[model samples]
Target: MTIGFSSRTSRVARVAVCCSAVCTLAALAVATNPEGAGLPFGTGAQDAKAGQEPPSLYRPGTQARPRAGAPRVPRDVSAVSWLVADAGTGEVLAAHNAHRKLPPASTLKALFALTVLPGLPAGLRHTVERAELAGVGAGSSLVGVKENRTYRVADLWRGVFLSSGNDAVRVLAALNGGWRATAEQMQDKARSLGARDTRVVSPDGYDAPGQVSSAYDLAVFGRAGLRNAEFAAYCSTATAKFPAGGWSYDIQNTNRLLTGAGVDRYPGLIGIKNGYTSKAGNTLIAAAKRGGRTLVVTVMRPRTGGGLAVYEEARSLLDWGFRAAGRVDAVGSLVPPRPAAAPQTGPESPPVLEEKEEVTGPGWPAAGVITGAAGLGAAAVALALRLKSGRLVRD
Candidate 1:
């Protein structure tokens, strides 16, 4: 079939370019990645035997699909593992060691929030219980949930998003039943979302023995969360008030790209979440909108620079994804497979594309490409469309 992509959105098509570093197992297995966590994928005979192969470009020591005229994936990307993808279509523009699992730190909260946000009403009120906060891990970030205090569920969510608070996650997990139960629910939620790389050990994303998530899974959580109205509201919220006894204090979101708290303000930025630990270093999920397109990026455990590299790398990736839009094809897809009759844990779980209704719009992106304009201005996109004829996309 023949399809015409809008010069604006076409720019997003197949924008993925070559990765500077084809991260190998030896290069990735740094001290920060404990217990051979950075091992490259698709190395052994086992990988060849396994029926469920990830997109070729995403395996260990691999680069994203390369296009003739496309720009290179930013070499300055310092994270050990990272991915850039279209949020709406779940089309992965670029990835490097995308499935390498490592400690997620607080960024795992996005999964926790996604697991619970749908079932709970934002307006529901609950009083804090001391027992609920008891299991919070040491050195964990806190949003200061006070005992015997009544708070709207919205406020608690703010605590979770804005402060990355374990205390608030504890209370909400308590409300959800218990933290242990919530962790199990989160695991199920990850499976349903096709985030096969994540293992939920704590709903709060605290460092734990078995807790780990991949760049691909974190991007999955960010993209899925952006689809929900409540999730969108909470994550995008820059600052909010929380009760402290009779008074309240303000807490700003730690997402540097959102509030520009420690870094320069990112244009068209939509908040997602950020995380850190002595072990995890700095892991972040950031989404930005521009020219009718939204892109999400995940960076896990930068090796050289400290926490700042996480935000800077995300910014660099956002810039690349926007510019590369319509210039390349997706190396692999982030879309979860459709329901199939097969074992969930086995090596045969391959990708199954979701069924779509039909395309009726004048300038719709092709079958696999998803595009939409956001609240941000589209003047640049408008000009780009005016300068060039629409790109032809054949499916």
Candidate 2:
């Protein structure tokens, strides 16, 4: 009896009513806005708060206390979180523990793609990297790329998505500078994009102590990745051929949503990424487009099983999102709750915010806002916890 996003839609009208009743629970989460009113113009914080948890948004069965025999939304495959969003508008569509930072496994390639696509000269080709073979550290997956072999940057991009090629990623990272500098650049790019909970410790999303990202951060990466037409095209490919020592080898996409056989199908599904480890279990970041609307979904540390659970969850979520987005209103009135006395202002504090927070403006914790918004419908507020920041308690 797994509760699903689609299963919840049968009660959308009820959800709307319930939302009007429940919005006050979150009023204290807002800053300085006593009325908890609609967003103010150019104030990014207001916009993010508006998006944080919509009044009408409903996800099935995410209440604080569970009813007996209730179907549980799957836990992440790792100890971290996950998120989803619309690539075109960069709107968050769904999330699960989106701010909880944890190892990304190979999913970090998406960021590698983002960093490489924008900085490199246009039409630059990839050549087999000499260092790719000489131990780029541990956890390397072999796509059998021959040392010193040459391929187009475009071709390597396909390898990165299809095979989760650490070697190829190392080559790309090294091309920018070195792994250390490349990782730093990725951090910078993440910061610029407002991925507050994201921190990179490796060129590959390997299991490093501090290498982590939230589902929200991944969604941000996904949104940014989609902007690179080449990377987007590469990720969509189920298979790619690259030359190695004058011969061609085929690499398959690790993302089961795109190429996995016998999985529940998601209509309009497009490209993204997947990850796994004994510790991480199964992780995935997927995207799809329907009726001019696009959505991204990330599943981290999901229940261990046939590995089809991720797709099943994804399929259900996409179905619900497409329907919900069409029928639901994105804006609503905020019920003013008794303030908890605004985090205690100091004598040095500036009055009146000094600067009013702008909507969709810079510096808001994008990861928290997006993840919290995605969890609104599901009642899964745990999705908004930031694990790296020690915000969410571990189970």
Candidate 3:
């Protein structure tokens, strides 16, 4: 049998066939490796991967989603996940996709600092060895540490916060034995602090498989870090001397909210951390004080290429949080650290350490933000649609 069709119908048929094929591949891709699919929580099989849940501003059981009474989030805010909480009370005031895990980029550095800062003496100095800098990921950010140059522990912390320096993280991780050890410690610390969605695979927060965190957890890190005078000081420093000598390098805080460089310096803004990678997009955790009330806001994976979008989104959330204070009931509370346990003497059990205190979305994809093969399939469908219709169709 011969199929009869007009020119327009033929073109349409071809387009439809192409779209169908692309979508099938996308579906299959998502089906095969659902976990790697980067879909937001609650949208795909990935969400069911034990311990994951849908993003919601209101705490679980307050309501399924944000009610009209909740603070109004800016329509223009582009992050896939965000949250605001009372820094002092650990109360999560408002959030969107607060529990959805995504790549953290350099923002994970905050956790690194939290895990290792207490162990290293501020005045302790170590010579930067060539091996310490080796194996840093390509295109990673740096504070220009040079081999053979000795740096104070405090200085390295400053680099981590100011320059978002991968080099600084590497050196410090080495001081703790190695990056792997530091990452393990960071993960352990994250669990103890109630950051349920964090998995620290890289000490420097470089993009790595399974290295993920949620907005809620990032805020937890900020709040926990602020308890440490040193963590707070390092993050808040607007500028720091990289090497204290003639070859001194001035590194500025990458957090525009504090610096007011590419964006308006947020009033009452305090130190925290921000991060980005092609995979992670833009992420930020910001803290500010107003009328004795301290609020920490975290935004992750905001739309890329919009200058200052992350800070702007954070500012919006902070404003909403302050306005909603005493008005909106908290959906959840950031759990306080586990109390220090007395030393245990057993081959199987290690001694517990004391705790230090500190300060501190969007939508689901239809196929649930499929990543890896699923992401490629989605890309194929999008590309085909764009080519055929000359209009962008985002998944």
Candidate 4:
């Protein structure tokens, strides 16, 4: 007992240093305050604790345990932003630039599906309107939703999950009302899910002027999405038949990790989403289970590798996360949804965050008051670990 107390006191003295880092991260949501970051000011973000926003995520580089027994985070991760988390427990195994917002690409569709799928019944069929397909961005992916063809909601979702179809997303958004309203509802849904970094300018996740999300937010979406049965079925769906003009044909999931279409099929992979654009590079959210443990990994814009790097990086990270589990400490946690409460005000029609400055490194001097939150929010910083800094994707 004497030995244990001595060890504890020394460890506490060391970790007290990083308390400031988590404090900066808590204040990093300056945009979340008055401007609201598409969220109501008091969505409990400031009050959130218990590693709700893990401190090391702001390290601007790789984060891992320094102790001898702790599994190291993969050195070659190379993505601009990445995160590996326990889907079952919401413990973030590790992260890099976890909340540094960037364009999300089609991975945003997971949130779209999560937001809209619950309300629309699978058996409900709607005829495709020309207007619904009209606004799909040029060169956006398509699951071939043809105009005037009646499609069951299930079919549209199959198109979305299998093909990453912007056309299908537009149609689904229209059925939810219109693209704009669906975007609002998506924003509301994101805030409710504690995904503050996401700004859903297009339900399809096209690279609009201000459209962006972070690897951390994507992991949150993936973890929450798996909890919903329909979302899980759609994402895990490898292939499905779609109706054409008078016939039907098959479509395959673009998430190569799930289907192994062109990339190596990751064993025990769960279907999530993948996306790319000239602007976003490559982005993915992948989940897999092994030994009864499921891990979710999100990679946004790996800048250092081949075209399939997103899946490869996700696979590698998932591998590391499993290896690092319990060996390395959780840097943070996936915060649960804020309890429903009346907003201080109504939804602002426009996205509130359009910050010009980016937090490319740690301690970039952000705004907001972080009291009682910066220190060990979810779990204490790993006592045996020492952080090392490194510098670093797309989609």
RMSD of each candidate?
20.8, 19.8, 18.7, 17.1
lDDT of 3 by residue, 124-233 (tens): 98998999999899999988888898899988888889999898888999999798888889999998886878998988889999999999899999998888898988
Model 4 has an lDDT value of 0.81
Off by over 4 Å in 3: 1-71, 336-395
lDDT score for residue 166 of model 2: 76
**Model 1 shows how many backbone clashes?**
12
Cα lDDT of candidate 3 equals: 0.78
Error of 4 at 361 (Å): 29
**lDDT score at residue 285, model 3, on the 0-100 scale:** 91
Runs of candidate 2 with Cα error greater than 4 angstroms are 1-80, 121-129, 329-395
What digit string (tens of lDDT, one per residue) describes model 1 on residues 45-104? 444322244456346853576578988889988789999999988888888888888999
Error of 3 at 20 (Å): 59
**Each candidate's TM vs. the true structure?**
0.74, 0.63, 0.69, 0.73
lDDT head-to-head 1 vs 2, winner: 1
Worst 10 residues of 2 by lDDT: 56-65
Candidate 1, after superposition: displacement of residue 172 in Å? 0.2
> Ranking by TM-score, best first?
1, 4, 3, 2
By the lDDT metric, which is better: model 2 or model 3? Answer: 3
Worst 10 residues of 3 by lDDT: 357-366
The positional error of residue 169 in candidate 3, measured at the CA in angstroms, is: 0.8
